[model samples]
Target: IMRWNKNIRLSCAYLFRIKYNGKYLLVKGNRIDQYQPIGGVYKYYASFNELKTKLEIEDEEEINFYEEGDLRQITKGKYLEKFLDWFDTKKNREVTVIRELIEELHIGEISIEQLIKSMQIEYLKTVKEEIKFSKHFQVDELKIFNIYEVRIPDETLAEIINNDKYSLVEAGEINKLCFMKKGLSTKISETSKYII
Candidate 1:
């Protein structure tokens, strides 16, 4: 059985399957030990402007607003629209995925242009009309998880390890680089088999 939260709103996440030498890349955040995919939550509205009239600002000049239940309902459509825009932009997907890889895992050798040229996008699956519950909040998300595979040479992998952007811990110590296949999971707010 699934629990429902009345405060549910839409959210988007990306799951990258960065494969090298047969295994896929898995990352554990600085604060946690459990490894997940190399992705993060995509914030639909970085600022109040993106919300437009959906979110009522008390002060139109300063964009002051109270955080409450009604605000979630009002902004649900904006979140859904942002996710739909992401879904429709195929080329943007490749670029954003590549940028995220570089930012998260420090996979810097591959450029956006090169990835756009050589990357293979496998539309894994979609989870529509699902409500994900957490301790902090609940989200009714149309989550789409896709796998991106790119082959990198040994030297480039070494470069990633030496870079400052690669900061993941493994085995109670800082790991230069590591890849695994079994424990790989998506960056969804809720745990589901669709991610695998």
Candidate 2:
């Protein structure tokens, strides 16, 4: 079951899928009739550790599949809580707009080579780095202007979109679960300009 303080906002999940032609993303196809990722938000718990534990359990009960961890294998930086605090500006309220892009959607391990192949762009140089302009300003950067590639399998992407196995539920209330995936676009837009 999921639980959260009344003040805490729900986390959002966004799933990206490969195109049917096996090239580029299927931007127009997957958007809900309402538009965007087919998932919604649920309230957050008191602590990330607690939330992580509950997430694994919910994944099993809802999808019959258990994910090993709550946070994705992105390049490490500040704790998620800090990011939430910074974004929401309400210290008492924990609001995390989590983007759940599936690595399996691309098939094979996530590698620069795979991205290059999938993007279908010739490269002469590639760069992966943790951009840190200052102690507080930091971000994960993956550049493939040249000399790098990555391939994302279409079948893998389809499996995620077609399965309909995952549920976006609250951490404290299981009943909070529902099949809603619309609205709040301004709040959860893909671009970072809106985050501020």
Candidate 3:
């Protein structure tokens, strides 16, 4: 019999597919070093401190500065199924895309009302990265991402963001493997293609 470790790393994130003119919007990645969709790991509120300890979940090894409390965590493998059930309850952890939308898009100066009126979004699909041993992190990680499509009714944001921080690439070219940078094209992150 093949024996596996009874340890797991669970993570969940919300990603948005913000498209315009037949191209998808991608932001330069800071963590893995390539353009990626706009969204990040879910965060849990401090009120769940008790459950956090019980599950033995901790911050991901990656450096994070966002402040809420990283939901990317480690726990005994035996708790994996149980934890997922709890997550579905939508208790204690973040369940909205608003935080990431505002933060990633640099949406400030405008109230939530403005933000809401400017765009339309709906649930798209869930991309599941089942439990697997990550050689880089040396932990078995299980990740789930809820994707949504954000459609801007006007050019409000497209006109505002005129910087290199964001890049719009054709849908067909997204998986072409590389995005040009500084006149030289380098390989893009594989995760970006999974969204399609």
Candidate 4:
């Protein structure tokens, strides 16, 4: 899933090249419950060389569910071009951006790129305990890295450490993807940052 504010018309797709059992696995999803591809957002390493390393680690950690095989990206270059346009211009809401990803990149069924994007989106939705919430729920928290103050804590962050390793998810606050997009008027202001 991808997130761009309401002002930007952009889409994000998780691209994956996998060969398992001689058959490729593709993931797809929508607002409704269903299976989607697996993968996370890339904050750095926009180039293919750098992205490949990020993809490798993610594949080993998450995409490994798919049959074993070589990994590659069928969707090359301009991977974030469409989304960047909106992200650079309008400053859209993170949730809206992810929703747009659900609407645009979901082709026929699920794919690696879609899956990674979806996973990254889900990871970012997690909130910290200090944040207050009207309701209590359990969700896994995903960490984000700021290039300026990059450091690794005891826990492994969902975010990529090296730009050469993975692309970073644009949303850092983790507040944007907190609420479930059940409808158009879904208000997340009251929700705790910790709720995913």
Candidate 5:
């Protein structure tokens, strides 16, 4: 069963352990040197009613019709406190994961469908609640890093890397993926342990 952290904050993020053929997919962006899983920070939005009022959305049905892109645009410049909400609900978390898999990872619909079918939630690390202060903002984060692994065909895996904004790294070069050790301490410490 999937666990939802009621205290999820905007500073919190998700990362996938997309495994295929003894290798895991780690991504490095054009700007960043560190290679990490394909995921991003979760954004909060207003309640359906509040969003409707703020966006001047009329039809009650249309109020809940916003897609991921639409939601981002509509919520721009809005205070998180005024609209912040958690994936406290199971359905909300599932939807967020689906969206993240598609949007952030660039996983195709067919591949994503297959991947979801094989996903199993495994608890990897749990950091106790603490106040994190940055240069611009501060947040109390009770971060829980979870791992979800799925196997895919070699061809499909190649396609994912070639077609997406990510580059592939060999399983032997696990150290390139910075957060791997932080999250998957024991399971990924030795390449032999994870590659197989």
Candidate 6:
């Protein structure tokens, strides 16, 4: 059970880094109302219910109805390394990035069916953020981000970036948590730096 004095978040996320014209593409976040990388939290499969129950993992209630079973959850701090170990096995979890990309980019089935050949996806880096007190959520956040570099054709990228829901930040302008708007000095998203 989550206690009032201590709250620990153990969650994993995968993010995509797409670049065009020296600018990286960032999409508006659903929960925080800020620009972030085109990605979401990993999800545990139904078969993991045994462990979920054992761990007393609670379903995410902050997001919409569809995000009921994502891999994001809060628990005791003692389960920190154990959670990452279970996640490294890559079993009983959503491992593919296709689902998130299709959801965030709104790609058609035809376009997605042929994406593998036209798109070059590779693991970029993994960032492990130490448990720290968050003033916004009023809890200690422990997060791991599996960042991937997704390379697509310039034409398709331009088309996707045209959407108002997306923002462009230059490579140099990216700070630890925020980035300046393309050709401007406006900053957005404190957590977007993880994608870099």
Question: Where does candidate 5 stray beyond 4 Å?
Answer: 1-10, 30-33, 43-45, 48-96, 105-131, 135-144, 170-196
Q: Model 3 over residues 64-163: C-alpha lDDT tens digits?
A: 5333487777788766766788888989988888877777775435555676788888898888786789887787778888888888755666653566
Clashing pairs in 5: none
Q: Which segments of candidate 2 are over 4 A away from where they belong?
A: 1-9, 15-66, 71-83, 86-112, 117-196
lDDT of 1 by residue, 86-191 (tens): 4455422232445565566445576556445554555454445444443433333344444444455555555554553233233222132233324653231222
Q: Which portions of model 3 show Cα errors greater than 4 Å?
A: 1-5, 61-68, 107-113
lDDT of 2 at 66: 21
Q: Mind giving the per-residue lDDT tens digits that candidate 5 earns over 1-196? A: 0112222223234556676555566665434445566654444444454654663322212233223423222222233334334233422233354556666544564456665564454434322224233232232223333344545556656667765346444555565323333355322222212322
The local distance difference test score of model 2 is 0.28
Model 5: how far residue 81 lies from native, Å? 16
Best by TM-score: 3
| Candidate 2 worst ten-residue window by lDDT | 187-196
Where's the lowest-lDDT run of ten residues in candidate 4? 145-154
Off by over 4 Å in 4: 1-6, 26-32, 44-196
For candidate 1, the TM-score is: 0.48
> Can you write out model 2's per-residue Cα lDDT over 1-196, one digit (the tens) per residue?
0112211211222233223443222222232222222222223344545534433322212222223332221222323344334324433222322222323233344544544444432222222222323221132321111111223455444443453333222222222212234442211223111111
Question: Residue-wise lDDT of candidate 6 within 1-196, one digit each (tens)?
Answer: 2443365876688889988887888887776667778887898889889877776666656655236678878866556556678889998898888788878775533366556567888998888887788675577888788999999888777767777788888755567456555554554565567666
**Model 4 residue 34 CA deviation in Å:** 2.4
Q: Alpha-carbon error at 88 in model 5, in Å?
A: 5.0
Task: By lDDT, rank the candidates, best first.
Answer: 6, 3, 5, 1, 2, 4
Clash numbers, per candidate: 0, 22, 1, 30, 0, 0
